[model samples]
Structures are given as structure tokens and as C-alpha cells.
Target: MKLVKSLVAVAITVSMFSCGNQVKEVKTLNTEIDSVSYAIGLNMATQFKANLKEVNDDAFIQGYISGKDSTNLLVAQKDIQTIINTYLRKQQTAKMEEQRAKAAKEAEAKFGDNKKAGEDFLVENKTKEGVITTDSGLQYIILKEGTGDQPASPSTRVKVHYHGTNLEGEVFDSSVDRGTPAEFVLNEVIKGWTEGLQLMKEGAKYKFFIPQEMAYGAQQRGDKIKPFSTLVFEVELLEVLD
Candidate 1:
């Protein structure tokens, strides 16, 4: 009986690895098979492999272990492997789904508040071209216009000089601070930028009243901006590439 079980396990291992097109599938199948096999083998190894040597009659071993009588044991081994494979596959799939749900919940929680703040700013300012609104609700007027080609769509690289400030008149980031024009793809910039630049021709300067939503929403503007901040940018459309 012990020799019969050992032979059955070995035969199943051989058959599993034999199919050509199923080679990769079989390797994954084998990993699951090996896990169960390891548990079973550890529990039964002494009886299945070592005790066979103590059997006194060779004919009794050959009749019961080698020929037609071994068929039932082989069937049983295949059934056990099938059961273990089904169990582990279901366990892993459930774990993955649980992780996905957790990630989605966290994102909604983090971004929801900021999005609401942006919507509030939009309601108060009512978006119009060339208007400037500051964090504490002060506004500025555009003083000059430049002569340049205007961007018609989201597609275009632009060059500009800009100064930003709060309602209390504190300067934030400025291209003037670096004494050079800021260059970037218009479509790749913030919503206020993409919208405002489209309204100006290359060499045209416009003062933009960027509400928090159109700028950075309720998010902090790097080290320079605070939550629920509106911004003023005096932008010059120096050039448009493509």
C-alpha cells in the first residue's frame, strides 16, 4: 500500500511535466502541487518510501504495487492535487481584490476635500479672461498687452514671464526672480495657464486672476502657496513653439 502511493505520486509528477504546449501552465501548476505535495510527503515519507524495503515477498510487492492494482491509488493522487490547486487559486484572487478596493477608497478620501474648495473659488470669481484674484480676495488689473501669436488649442509650447502674489501683496515664484522667461508646453501646465495662454498671442501680455481651482485647487503651491489660495500672474506670451 505504501509503495503503491509513492509510485502514484511519482507518476502524477511525470505526467504533469510531459505536455509540450502546457509547459508554462504546468510550471505554475507544479508550484501549487509542490506545496501540497510537500505537506503530504513530510507526513507520509517514512511509510511510503522506507517501509517498502521491509516487505519480505517480492511477488506480493510486484502484484500489489506495480501492475493493474496501482490504478486506484493514481486516481486518488490526482483528485488530491486538484482539490489543493482550487483552494490556493481562490485564496490568492480574493486577496488581490481586497487590496484594490482599499487603494480606491484612500484616493477618494485624500482628493475629495481639495476638489470641493476649488469649486467654491470658481463660484465666487466666475471665470473670465485677464482677471486677477488673490488669496484674501483682492483683485488686480492687467496693465499692458504684448504682441505675439495666440495659442488656439492645448497643443503648443509657450514662453512667458510671470509674477505671482497673495491678496496682502506678497511675491511668490517669479520668472522675474530668475531673470528669464519660463518655458513649457501650454497643455501640460495648470488649468488657469492653459486657458489664459490660449487667450493671448505670442508677445501679448495678460494679467490672469487664477482662482484656486484653476490654479492648484486647495493644494499648497509648493513652498509658496497655502490652502484655498487664489493667485495673480502677469504673463507675457513671448513665443509659441509648434
Candidate 2:
């Protein structure tokens, strides 16, 4: 009877120990599952916040809010804003480039017209003297007579004083402003000066009505002159040193 009682006590103790081990294992597994689920949930929330920030800061969204009703049409508003912003930027750039090209073309045209006009004036004026006539029906008078021999053909070095005006009697360039005589070579100057100086002897002065071609051509000498303008000048021959 004593041996049997001892064996029964040993069996009960082994069973209790086995049951406690099973309970501990189950608790550990449950804790691991709960931790994984929490991590997944946290990650999902973080991803959502990032997406929200991106959508809010996008330019398309801002544009939609400016023009459209966003309260009821969120998707449509966003789309419209994107399209409108893109279109406007492209249009603005294209228009600016077009304006630049147009300005360049106008400048070129003015220059060509002035050059042609000057050539025509030289052709019409047949007489060569201190005085000259322009095709534009303007006339120039000589003021002083030069004594030195004229320079070689196509040569440029010469010194003179000049006063310019328009047919309506508008004064333009005047050497008297700087209180000094203007100097330039014939070849280096406008067509009008080149042709006109050839006719002058040393100590001779001539007045000229220079068309745009003979003056600055298409370019304006200053604010007072315009493109394709006509000019008048009283030139006094001081020296022909070339």
C-alpha cells in the first residue's frame, strides 16, 4: 500500500508540470502575433500620411482650388487644375519667343529700306559740287571750300564740322555740342558722307540732306531719329589728311 501511494503522487506532479509548460508556450505565441499586427497597422498609417502630403502640395491641387469648386468635385478639380497650369506656362513661353522674332524682323526690314533709299538718292542727284540733291527731293548747300587735295578713292581719313537737320528744320547731330570738330574717314562713314566728301575740295564746306540710307540707315542715331529717317547736314571741310 505504501509503494502504490508514492507512485501515484509522482504521476500527479509530472502531469501538473506538463500542463504549466503548455500554458506558457501558448502565451508566448499570442504575444508574437499581437506585436506583428501592431507593426503592420503603424506602417499603414505612416504610408497614408505620406500620400496625403504629396497630394496637398502638388501644383495641380493648388490651381484647382483657385478656380474651381473643390467641395464636391475633388477629382475633377485636381485634373482641371493640372491641365490649366500646364497650358498657361506653355502659352506664355511661346508668346514671348514670337515677340522676340517679330522685333528682329522689323529691325532688319528697316535697315534694308533705308539702304535702298540712300542709293536711290545718289542716283538722282547728277551734279557733283559743294552742293548735292537727294532722290527724296532734298537739297544741300556748301558752306566752306577745302584747299587740300582729296584723298584716294575709297580712303576714309578726313576732318570736318557738321550740323544736321530735317526737311521740316529739325536739328539732329551737331559737332558744336562737343565744342570740337567731328572727324572720320569717308569709307568709314555713311554712304552720304562718302559720296559727298568726294565732291569737296580742301577748304570747302557743304550742306547735305541725307536720307536714312546716307545717315544711320535703319538705326536711329538717338531718340530724336527714327528708323528709315532722313537727315540734313552742313559739313565744313577742315582737312583731307588721308
Candidate 3:
């Protein structure tokens, strides 16, 4: 109900602006009522200017006048609500797409080479004797195989020590360096961790070569890892806390 009233106010303001020259302007606000009315109009005009470029001013004014007088209404109230909702949702989607496109352009200009570097490294890494590549492009080498049981499912919590690095082997994060094991539900982490951890048993150590898509993809994480980076991690599954 509030949104409907707001849209009506915006439509009225847009219509008034479109037909401003035809309407006689009142120079003097002699009465309190006249001053308040002028203030309200000014406020609405400022608020209405946003996202109103596509509005049809003439049609809006006709509808506004007709609805106010409760006469000759062309659209049902429920239909009007649906129309407004759909239009607003489409506008929001368009704005988000524009933003994403702009960001992709910027990322390509900056870290475009990073993606190529990761792809080249992965191609060679998969052919190594100990390295195993999964269908999803996740590559790993078992440093130590554990005899204990693996995590029951992706939802299970586990404690582990890890050393994380980019394709260049520059260390980014390490539970080993911090001297504390990290704990989390496997599904809550990145795709690489979620899938790789499930393959390991308790007390097993594996070195994962996670492709960009399984990692952050186009997202920048801190200063070391750029967009489309292939991440390397030495993970030791200490315990699977069901």
C-alpha cells in the first residue's frame, strides 16, 4: 500500500515536470497552506527524479487524475500492483547486469593474464605421476593416506591443518603457520575444499590443485590472490566430527 502511494506521488511529480511550462507558476506563497503545498511539491519532485526517465508522463497524469476522482479507471487496482512490481523487478535486474558487465571488463583489463597462467599450470600439473584429476577439474596428490574413516557427508564438520597458496606458490593463509587447526562444516567452504575433503580419511594429508572455477573464479580475495587464480592447498584432515 505504501509503495503504491509512493509510485503515485512520483508519477504526479513526473507529470508536473513534463507539463511545467504549460502550468502557471505561483510566485507568492502568502498563506501557510500555500507554503506547505509548495514545500511538498518540491520534496516530491526531488524524490521522483530518480529512475523515472522511462516513465510516460502524459499517460501517468491521465491515470493519476482518473484514479483520484474514482472515475473512468482503465486498470484494476490488483493489476496495477502487479504491473508496477514486474516493472520494478526488471529494472533492478537490468541494473545488476550492467554492474556485472562493468566489473568483468575491469577484471579482464587487470588480471586477464592470471587466468592464462592458472590454466597452463593445471595442464602440466595433471600429468604428474602422483597427481589425480577429478572430472570437475580438481587435482590432488595424496601425501599420506589415513586408515580411519572419511567424513560421512559434505555437511559433516571437520578439523584440519592447511597451507594455502596461489599458483605461484606464494603463501596466503596457513593453519600450520598459526599453530592452530581450523574447523568448519565441509559444505560451508569453497567447492574445492568441500569436494576434496570428502575424498580424504581422518589423518590423511593431500595437496589440492583447485581450478579457478572451483575456487573464487572472478572474485578477488585479499591482496595476494587475484581473480581467476588457481589455488594450491596442503590439507591434513585431522578429524571428522560427524
Candidate 4:
């Protein structure tokens, strides 16, 4: 009965496609495809367009058209290759650094209040009941106790649920939000997790306060996380996978 309903559903879907929008483009590629290529291409064009002016767009599109038509003779092939191999990397790097500086300046303007909040939070948090601070500056409070065997080494793989945030309590990442458990080698994570998990057993839950050095340090991860950012995590060890 389920199979029949599924077949009917498929038929209805097919009929909807057949009766509604008929794409006039020829299927020269044989395998099923859609306007995704055009959509993606248009999206990319808009993104680039946002960073450029009409004159720049005209120049780029005309140059591309020229390339497609094999009409280029103005610039030497070697010069074009040199532009790509030599100057492009430097230009891209400069642009990225400029963007990073801009982001840092903006972060100072936005979450500056919480910039020192983590340090203060940790200072008081460490004094709380059952809160243990390791010599290396990792602080954790046991949320749930486990009777299962504790991981013997950093090489052990474990499954866990975690929610990570910066000093300002802005969430950086969360397996809980994704509604999925994370499985990873114990040592493969940040130093804080590597050391903190060693004190845990299967079915154990702990809230960890990881200092900036133990986390991403002075380096940035993507855009949201900034340099020298302290992190807080609520980690639950679900299983010792290996």
C-alpha cells in the first residue's frame, strides 16, 4: 500500500512538471539536469558585480567574450600568464589582509563590550561549586558522571554533543543546533578538548572554559571567530568510538 502511494506521488510529481513549467532548453547532456548552472552562474555574476562598477563589468564581460571568440591579440599570452602567476596572488593576499583588518575593526565596534567578559566570567566561574581548574588553565564543571572506561590516550576517537561560544556568549559552533553528534579523534581537536576529554568517560557531560591560546589562538577561523578569542563549550561525551 505504501509502494502504491509512492508511485502515485511520483506520477503526480511528474505530471506537475509536465503540465506546469516546460523548459525549452534542449537536453544535450542526456543525463537529467536543470537551470542550476544558469542560476549558479547568475549568482556568481551578481556577487562579483556587487564589488565592481558598470564599466568594470562591461570590461570583464567583453574581455570574456573576446576570449571565448579567440579574438585576443592585444595582450601577450605570456603577460596574461604572468599576471595570474605573479601579481594575482599578491593582489589577492593584500585584499584579504585589508578585509581582515576591516573585520577586526568592526568586531571591536560590535562585540567590544564582551571582549573582556570571558576573562571575568572565568575568574568567577572557577570559584563555583564543583568547578575544577587544571594547571594549564582549562576549567570544567561535571554535568553528568559516567561509569564507563575513561579514554587512555588522545588518539581515542569519541562521539560528543557540543555547543561552542566566544567570550561574549556568541555561539560559534554547535552540534546540538545541528541536531547531530560529532565524532572525532580526541587529540585532533583544540588542546583544551584534548586534555579535558582525557578526564571524561563515556556518557559524561562537562562545560569547558578554554582560553584563547588553547583554542584558535591569534589566528582567525573563517570570519565569525576572531583572533585571541576565549571560548566556552558544553560537551557531552556520548561514546568512545574507538
Candidate 5:
């Protein structure tokens, strides 16, 4: 409907431009009605120039005259709005896709190195003793083994203390530092935590080397956790609450 209004404004400008020769004959706008009409015409012309670049002036003026006279309309009045709305929707979709593509390119340029560093770190770390790499690219080492039962499913809620850090060992978050155990359903966490925690029994402590794809991926969490970052965490399984 907004686009329709803009098109109407453009059409008014086109109508005035088309009738420029006839308007020149009436030079003086002495009456208030005449002055107001001229001023609105000027405003419409300015709006058309600012809002639209490409318009068929001849067809627009012809359509305007036909519409005003209520005769010889090429399109039915009911169908005109539908056609215009469809065109406007397509334009909006194309513009949104263009913006997303531009944003993706910019993100890759900034975070490409972080992705490469994670890949390199994983390649070297996988060869170390006690470090186990899974099919999903999650790596971890059992720090303290437990004998209790493992969680039954990803939906099971569990309590645990964890110290999380970036690749540079800069701590980003920690329930351990706050002196409280965090608790949630395993499915609600990152892919790495969900998968890795399932491998542990109650009272188990594990150090995880989570790849970016299994962690936050391209999302920047805070000032400390940049986009495409691999995360490290020391997790202790306190209790399986359900």
C-alpha cells in the first residue's frame, strides 16, 4: 500500500509535467486555491524525483487521465492493486537476499582465520594420548572417571559445574567460578555439550575441545567469544536430575 501511494505521487508528477505547456498559459496564481494547487504540484514532483528513478511518463500520464475520468482503463480497478502488490513483494525479496549475501561475505572476511585456527588445533590435538575424537568432530578427555549411571537420553536434565574458555584460554563463562552448578536438559545446550555429556556417567569430569561447528559456529556470543570460535570447557557431572 505504501508503494501504491508512492506510485500515485509519481503519477501526479508525471501528469503535471505532461501538462507543462498548458500550465504556462496561466502565469499568476492570485487566488488561494490556485496557489495551493501549484505548491502541492511542486511537492509531488520533488517526491517523485526522490523516491522513483524509472517510470514511463507517457503511459503513467495516460493512465492517470483515464483513472481520473473513470474510463478506458487497461486494467480492472480491483486487479490493479493485486498486480502492484505482487511486484512490490518480489522487489522486497530480492533486496533482502542481496543484503544477506553481502553480510555473509563480510562475516567470512572477518572470521575465516578463526575457523582455520580451530581446524589446525583439532588436527594436532587428536593425536595426543587420552584425547578421544568423535564422528561429529567433538573431542574430549575423561578427567575423572565415574561409576554411576549415564543419562538415559538427550532430554534428561542434569546438574554440572563447568569452566568455559576460548582457544586462547580466556575464560568466557563459568558456573564453577560463580560457585554454583548449572542445570538444564542436555538437548538445550550446544551440539558438543549434548553429545559429550551423554558419554559421561554421574560424578565424571571431562575436558572438552569443541569445534566451532558443534559450538556457536558463526555467531559472536560476546566480546570474548568471536564468530567461528572453538570452545574449551572442563565439565563435572554432578547429578542426572531426570
Candidate 6:
């Protein structure tokens, strides 16, 4: 929602600047509109990325040229209007629904492989030395003990550095790689983090093995993190920030 709002504001601001107070005359209206159109293109180009599979730059520019001069159109103008009708906001709900269904099916197929791999990994991981399995199915191994006696609690906000990976050992996210410690309330993160952090004290380092249900569950995150992934993380509790 914030992304959409920011992009819309940028596009509007660019258009407004191109048609300033002193440039409202009818004689130069076409010229002013051309500037506004290019401004809008610049605004959208800054935000949206295109793919060769979907549409390339050449195809996009061809569409723009066709729209600008409808007379020399390769196809019937009536057919072009029909395509525009398809793009109307009111007509997109069903199309989006269909796309969502297709994506969900693809995710399901991927998760099928994920589930089998996760089950095998956890089964073998539990047999390793110092690996502790809790009643909630969270697993962890303490790498270093804390100097302080204070353990983390649900309401406690703490500064910590962490590195996360999947069962295949692919690094997905890391505060350590970014060279920064993150602060978060114990209860506000993934269920695995909330449970695992409470078992640690200040300055302690631990590695957590989190099942997907306790992490992202069925939701597909960005380009890296997928649906129903079993995650591993090495987390160090720096200090309770609040």
C-alpha cells in the first residue's frame, strides 16, 4: 500500500510541475501534455521492472507510439479499444483472481518437495550432539553461554545479530552480512524466534532450526524465501534494548 501511494504521489508531482501556473494557455496545451506524459513514463519506469517473458522495452515503446498516433495502427482501432476495455480497473478483479489461483497451484507443487526435504532433515538433525528439541517442535543448539543471568522475555526488545538460511543451506537473510544488529520485540517475530529467544540470556549465541509452520508457513516471500521452507538461523543476543 505504501509503495503504491509513493509511486502515485511521484507521478502526480511530476505532472503538476510540468503544467505550472504560467503554462495554462490552450496554444501550448499539447506541448505541456507531452511533457506530462513523459514525466509519467519516467515516474513509472523508476518504480516498475519489466521482464522479457511479460513485455520488453521495444514492445512497450511500440504500444506507446500506437497510442500516440491511432491512424497508422497495424491492427483495427476497435480491437485496440477492446484491449483498453480489458485494462479498465473495474474489469481486473476476475483476472487477478485467476492469476492468484495459478500462482497458488505452483506454490503447492514447490511446497510438496519442501515438506519431504524438511521432514528428512529434521529427523536426522535431532540425532546430532547438543541439539535440543522442544515440545513445540522448535530445535536449537547453544553455541556460547551468556555472561549475564537475564533471559529474554516476550515483551523484551533486544539488539541481536542473526543469519538465516534454508534446509539446502542457502543464505536468505542476515543482519550479520549487513553489519548491523536488529532490535525487535520477542513476541513480534516468527513463532520460532519468539520461542527460541526466550531460552537465551544476554550475550548468548544459539543456532535455531525452525519448521516452516513456525516461520512463514504457506506464504511465499520475495525471490529467495519460498513457501513452507524449513529455516536455520544463528542468533546472538547482544543486549535487551528495552
CA lDDT for candidate 1: 0.61
Which lDDT value does model 1 have at 212?
66
130: Cα error in model 5, Å: 1.0
Candidate 5 vs 6: which has more lDDT: 5
Give the 10-residue window scoring lowest on summed lDDT in candidate 6: 17-26
* Lowest lDDT block of 10, candidate 5: 14-23
User: What's model 1's lDDT at 220?
Assistant: 60
Which model, 3 or 6, shows the larger lDDT?
A: 3
lDDT on C-alpha atoms for all candidate structures: 0.61, 0.59, 0.83, 0.70, 0.83, 0.73
User: Best candidate, TM-score-wise?
Assistant: 3
How close is each model in CA RMSD to the real structure? 15.7, 27.5, 5.1, 16.2, 7.0, 14.2
Q: What are the clashing pairs of model 3?
A: none
Which of the predicted structures, 2 or 6, would earn the higher lDDT when compared with the native?
6
TM-score of each: 0.47, 0.45, 0.69, 0.51, 0.60, 0.55
Q: Mind giving the per-residue lDDT tens digits that candidate 5 earns over 120-170?
A: 999999999999999999999999998887999999999999999999999
> Model 6, range 113-206, lDDT digits (tens) per residue?
8767777888899999999999999999999989764544688888899999887788999999999999989889999999998888888999
| Off by more than 4 A, model 2 | 1-131, 134-139
Off by over 4 Å in 1: 1-142
- Candidate 3 matches the true fold with a TM-score of 0.69
Question: Per-residue lDDT of 1-242 in model 1, one digit per residue for the tens?
Answer: 44446645543333323234132233333476666655554545565334432333444333334333344343354475465456456655776678866754564466566445545655565555555655544333556665757776888888888888754468888898889998899878878788777767776767666766567654566766665566777887788877
lDDT of 3 by residue, 1-242 (tens): 44456656644343233343344467798877666666667765554565444667678767766676678888887799898777777877888899988887788688889988999999999988999999999999999998787998889999999999987779999999999999999889999999999999988999999999899878899998899899999999999887
State residue 241's C-alpha deviation in candidate 3, in Å: 3.6
